[model samples]
Target: MNWRIETKKTALLLIDLQDKLLSVIENRERVVQKAVQIVKLAKLFSLPLYISEQVPEKLGTTCKEILEVAGDVPRLSKNTFSASPILPADIPKNILVCGIETHICVRQTVYDLRMRDKTPYVLGDAIGSRNQIDHQLGIEEMRQDRVLITSVEAIAWEMIEKAEGAFFKEFLSILK
Candidate 1:
């Protein structure tokens, strides 16, 4: 199978990026920034975007920056740690995921996606945990499961595919 993230066949999934949880995560600012960047790319490419809030009432909604860039993308308010159940029916086969508490919500969501026969590419630099150990462990485990653990820049470049065109120039500006 082709492993590269084809713009048309992929969806961006942001999981449990709620304010309460994000506040305690390590490097919260970087995580949030990368997420915002990915959302912008999603909008530019018109790829389907989906977001999940573990428990909005208790955790609060997805952060302002993400929601602002995400525009009217569907946001799922779910109690389950794994977001697979509430993901929209029309979401693409390959999901690009990024969000908080890597060892828990993010990891579980990746596993569940694998079970559903969906390819989940977890954005390592855009996901975080309260501790670096948990974050690394989550990434390592996902890697062992054959999940693509990638970075925002890497995915952007892969999706862009070539160095020419107006969109390519815009993506370069975004990467800069």
Candidate 2:
């Protein structure tokens, strides 16, 4: 399938990156940092942003940095691993998803998004889990279902397309 990263038709879904969950994941810093970058670029390109907290009362709120970067973007508190029900009904057709526990929340959300007929793109580098095995397995599972697995930089540049435009220059500065 031809996957075009169209910012206008995409919404960035930041799922279950809560503090408690993040602390247990390996390379938490790197993953969260990349997620932050994705969120920033989504904002820069005017893409809608949606974030889900997995039972926030128990798992705690999403990290302060992610929350801050998300700004007033719609935040959903969901007990379901799949974020679809919590997400807005009018969300865009394309979803760029990034977060922790790839085998659980990330995997289920991707499946759910596909079931709903929305194109789900998993930002590979921006997702993590406590165990690398489960993380890798989840990615493979998503790929088997034809979900696009990609890096934040790939999606960002694809959205910008050209290096000389206003968005491209700003995106370059962000990458730098």
Candidate 3:
């Protein structure tokens, strides 16, 4: 498997990280921090971003932190557990996925993306579930299925490459 992340051909897919879910997800604060960090890098690289909500009327909109940095990115409103269908047809093949309910929305989306022949990278640190066991299980299931499971900093730095440029300095500030 080609583990190298090609930021030029990657789209960050944030699935169902809605306000309602965030309030209950385990390690909610850390998840938001990591997700926001990844969003910042996506903006830096001009990667396409695809966000979705699992019925915002019931679950509430995505967290303010995510939306604040998401810019004018479009949001797909869906009732289905899998978000793969909503991703734009023209996005690059590399899909960086994260968000709430790892056992449900996150897992389902990864499966669907694979069926569509897209390489789905599950950001381990940015994803969450209502419970730790379920979260671990979701990660295991996805990993067993050959999804490229990775952390936010690991993949982001791989995308960033050297740390001497203005872009690198901006990304470092995010850690502060």
Taken over the whole model, the C-alpha lDDT of each candidate is 0.89, 0.88, 0.89
Candidate 2 has what TM-score? 0.94
lDDT of 1 by residue, 1-176 (tens): 67677889899999988889988999999999999999888887888889999889887899999888888777899999899999866678889999988999999999989888888989998999999999999999889878899999999878887788997888877777
Can you rank all candidates by lDDT, best first?
A: 1, 3, 2
State the lDDT at 29 in candidate 3. Answer: 95
Off by over 4 Å in 3: none
Model 3 weakest 10-residue run by lDDT: 167-176
Global CA lDDT computed for model 2:
0.88
Question: Which residue pairs collide, candidate 3?
Answer: none
TM-score of each: 0.96, 0.94, 0.95
Task: Indicate which candidate wins on lDDT.
Answer: 1
lDDT of 3 at 20: 84
Overlapping backbone residue pairs in candidate 2 total 0
Q: Is candidate 2 or 3 superior in lDDT?
A: 3
| Model 1 segments more than 4 A misplaced | none
